[model samples]
Target: MNIATRTLLVATAALTGLAGTALPAASSTTGAPTTASNSCPVKAWGYRGHYMCGTKLKAGYIDWNRDGRTDEVFVIAPNRHIWHTWKNAGGWKEMPGRGRADDMVGDNGTGSRSRCIIVYVIKKGYRYYQNCHYNGRWHNWTTSG
Candidate 1:
């Protein structure tokens, strides 16, 4: 067969193989367990160690402790509040202030992946806020434009 035909067949076969798969539903907005468990089944890399199963937005990961390793994750929950957890930790915890976010960004600042900084836009007011971990502690969250 021609290259185009062969590619089509391969794609079809791959899709067929995935037909029986079903992605887990997003976690409920209320009464959802805060700890990770087998029922918290998000098949994504960010879900590797935490309890955030049905996050509403893409997950963000950072070193968070300046240890040159990415171990923290931030995700927007189904209720719009931002929640986070660490690798091999206890469970997911809501961010301070319980602010809702429309989008989030995380980076290591000017240093390596060790330095963690996160900025998120509020879902209601569209204002920006940020927090960072430095000097052996996490700075308070502050608002900005």
Candidate 2:
């Protein structure tokens, strides 16, 4: 084949390969693949450090790693289950307990450089459960019942 024809064929093949590339799918709170037809009740939300696309009822962020940057993202997925992911991993994982909660709140720990995360889960009408990530570990769900 002539030089011009050969060069044109090579360029066409490269363009075709580029056009066929697939993108990674966004994940739901359960780590399941999410598309446009999922049954998530609420719309996706943008957390401070990361974006969560699922049936996210509520979401909050904290510096769970104590790295001075807000990197941890927590969300209330379907069935009132709490799921969390960080900026580094970008994958959602269920919280330690299997308990379902109605609402969730997060806050940073006290003191300079404390870098701890305190999460509160509200259930029932007047009951609240607490959990925390401190000193590089997560504490299980706790309630004063």
Candidate 3:
């Protein structure tokens, strides 16, 4: 278990959960990792937060609200979990969840490309769960491991 191996394992755990789940991992083309948001306009999300990566090295972005624009950013912190965010009328809002973000996909409104945010959570290499915010409420990420 050298550093590279650990990094790969941790990155894999962050991308796909260690158990039963079926969502194709999104592709990230942001080749080099950015150190900090230093300039992300979104308030609650950028540069630093609970989910901000301290070291390891993994990240992604998505358009949580569809609007044909990217409004959410996720970072896989050294702790191996997903820190996330999105926007609303009030301001920026954090998508509430714990554990590494295994996989994330947009709810394409039955294939119309109307996007919504959904996150799959993985913990301890076995526990698995998912959550999403829709119709104005935070659904608890219940464990089904």
lDDT per residue (tens digit) for residues 8-64 in model 2: 754553333212222135454436224433234322233221222332334365654
**What TM-score against the true fold does each predicted structure earn?**
0.48, 0.49, 0.40
Global lDDT of model 2: 0.46
lDDT (Cα) of model 3: 0.42
lDDT of candidate 1 over 116-138, digit per residue (tens) = 44545433345566656666655
Q: What is the total number of backbone clashes in candidate 1?
A: 2
Choose the strongest candidate by TM-score.
2
Per-residue CA lDDT of model 3 for 1-145, tens digit only, reads: 6899967865676455523232222213222122333222222323334333333222246655456665655544323344455553232233454434544432333223333344444445645454555666656555554
What TM-score would candidate 3 get against the native?
A: 0.40
Model 1: pairs clashing at backbone N, Cα or C within 3 Å: 26-54, 66-114
Candidate 1 regions with alpha-carbon error over 4 angstroms: 1-59, 64-69, 108-116, 122-126, 135-137
- What lDDT does candidate 1 reach at residue 95? 63
How much is 74 displaced in model 1, in angstroms?
0.5
Error of 1 at 89 (Å): 2.0
